[model samples]
Target chain A: MKSFLSLLIAFVAINTELFAAEAGMPQLDPTYWASQAFWLILVFTILYISISKFYLPKIKDNLDNRENKIKEDLENANKFKEESEAKLKEYDLILENAKKEVLKIHFESKSTLDKDIQSKKESMEKEIEKEILKAQKEISELKKNSISSIQIISGSIVSNIIENISGDKLNESSIKATVEDVSKKNMNKFL
Target chain B: MQQFTVQRIGPEINIVGVDLSFTNASLFMVISAAVIMLFLFLGSKEKKVIPNKLQLIAEMSYTFVAKMISDTAGSKARPYFPFIFSLFMFVLFCNMVGMLPYSFTVTSHIIVTLIMALFIFIAVTIIGFIKHGFKYLSIFVPSGVPAVLLPLITIIEIISYLSRPVSLSVRLFANMMAGHTMLKVFGGFVVSLGILGGWLPLSFSVALTGLEILVAFLQAYVFAILTCIYLNDALNLHH
Candidate 1:
């Protein structure tokens, strides 16, 4: 209140000084001051009322709405980006799992195939050994049969030559015994 | 001088002892207010997310004043934004309308500017008192002053404080009045000097008109910013 009163006093003092100095100036005219003041106050009041009541709120709302929309749009964009990133991570995980699956299958099949091959090879080797032993026994029997035939043929020939040369069918048993003894002594050479 | 005269218009009207007669000043004031209202009305009527030129101007003016207040007075001055915005638009439109040929400049009058300044002065003083109580008086006393010089500093501070309204009102009035007067004086020179010699003064008048328009906007800006500064002092009470 003191400040307001002092303000009024100061205003009067300043107005008086200004008015006294510029008495001829039209702005200093006291008669028009009242009307000017009245109209100024009236017009300014209407302006203030209309602005505060009507226009400012409208502008504020528009700005606020636009700001909210922009914020919403930005948030949506961020959400979409994050979603895509998550999808990408999921895709990568699936690809890794598939790769692991393929490796597992490959190892499983490889081990099964290796076991089958090992058994087949073992059976094949057993069959081959059995065939080799049978062939060896057959070859020894053929050799033994050929050697006895040769010995028999040689003894007949020798006996026939001696009968023709000596012109005597001398004692068959003694001849046969001599032939057997000689054959036994010279068997290695004849064969 | 003739331009500044508040000629009576229509019938004489008086209320109490005051001359409530509608004058040219009143008419222009009404015109300025109407122009502002119309501008705001048309600007906000659509309220599109994408604003047209008129709406753009309206929004710009709002934000302009909004930023000005926030910049100078901080958020504490938000409640008074409308008053300050209206004041700026009124003064700006008045000055702009006055720039028209044969138009009377409302701010050229001392009484008009003084009224506004005194009102702001009182309002800000009241706000200061309300906000700080007796501590508001400490505004007149400077800190860090030697005790011996404190009295002189306090007296100076009070005088300066009281002179706020006077200076605020006078600064605007003098600038508008002087700028308009110079333009009129130059215009007279252009007419008095015949065509051949008239070119110089005519050119000078052109330059002065441009300068006056700039001053018109500048004075309104200065007026509003000063009001914000005063509002800041009242609200914050910083030395």
Candidate 2:
């Protein structure tokens, strides 16, 4: 602040005298000022052109390049996201197929176990049916053989008893009764 | 009150090793430039999404230039946006700086404004020639005119087109010089009068100051917009 004040004071002290000298010196014609203005403008135009060509265009190009880079990055990001989503979809389908294969294997295993159990049950039933038929045939055959023996023994015993009881008459019936009586007494020797 | 006077303050290039120098007006011009730079830099420091007081001023200036470029130059002129923006801001700052209590307006000088206007004139002319080659000369030729009137109409068109720089610079410099001189003269009157007599001139000065502010903004707008129009002539030279 002090330096600025001093500079201002110095400029004031210097310019005041210069202005006095220039003033009251009969003004330069107005047309001269206009001509000076014309030349000054020419100089300014040259400066602006130099600056515009050298400095401004580079600044503008830098700005444009930055904008273009941002746009390109955004586009690339979108494409990458799309590609990743496609890969994700493919992975999901593969995962789903693998699950289905596991389920199919489990179902086939269970059905095979069930088939084995059903076959074992059917063979066991057939064997039991065959054993039951054989046992029935043996029992019937033994009963027939025992019935004939018992009938013959009973006939002889009845004849011997008739003969002992009724001494007098017999005839054909009497012969049977005498035989039965003889079988009962000597029973063994009876004819 | 004491009389104002000028005296030697410093040395420069001289006939006998004495220093050459500047004047009171030149000194004030340097001060004006400094003040303008300070105000603009400070005003922009608090740039916010929603502006504070200083930022509002800065934003208003930005909007002013943007609107001018869009209106006069059209969308094609958008590529030159920053240059036009800087020009408007610089001129506007210089004008407002002059409105301070004891400040001198550098823009009141023909040298300053003529420098500006001349640059625009040359730049636009060069751009026209470059863009359209020799065909740009047809801008001076009147269209659909009778063959007998061709020479007369062509002279009128040439004079009108040639007067652009004069009109552009003079409007700004003359207005600034006239307004300040009037203000100074009226200020002398108010000081010379006492008590009740001073009131009328004081009030008038106040209204004039307000009007001067509006003129200041308008002058800056006119300058920038005219530049845009010239730019359009270069890019698209319409009859």
Candidate 2 per-residue lDDT, tens place, A1-191, comes to: 58655654554455455445556421222523433343334433443453345433443344355567778989999999999999999999999999999999999999999999999989998888888888878777765554444445555555556667975434555555555565457633522
Looking at candidate 1 chain A, the ten consecutive residues that score lowest on lDDT are A14-23
Isolated chain A TM-score, each model: 0.46, 0.39
Q: Write the per-residue lDDT of candidate 2 for residues B181-237, one digit (tens) a residue.
A: 557655654664546456666787888898888888889888988899989877877
Give lDDT: candidate 2, residue A104.
Answer: 99
Q: Model 1 Cα RMSD, Å?
A: 11.1
lDDT of 1: 0.89
Error of 1 at A96 (Å): 5.1
Residue B157, candidate 1: alpha-carbon lDDT: 97
Give the alpha carbon lDDT tens digit for every residue of A1-191 in model 1.
58655654554466456445644678877888899999999999999999999999999998888789889999999999999999999999999999999999999999999999999999999999999999988887976786666556766676778889987766656656676687678766844
TM-score, model 1 to reference: 0.74
Per-residue accuracy of model 1 over B1-239 as CA lDDT, tens digit each: 66787889999888887788999999999999999999999999996888899999999999999999999999999999999999999999999999999999999999999999999999999999999999999999988999999999999999999999999999999999999877876676555555755677688889998898899999999999999999999999877
Chain B TM, cand. 1: 0.98
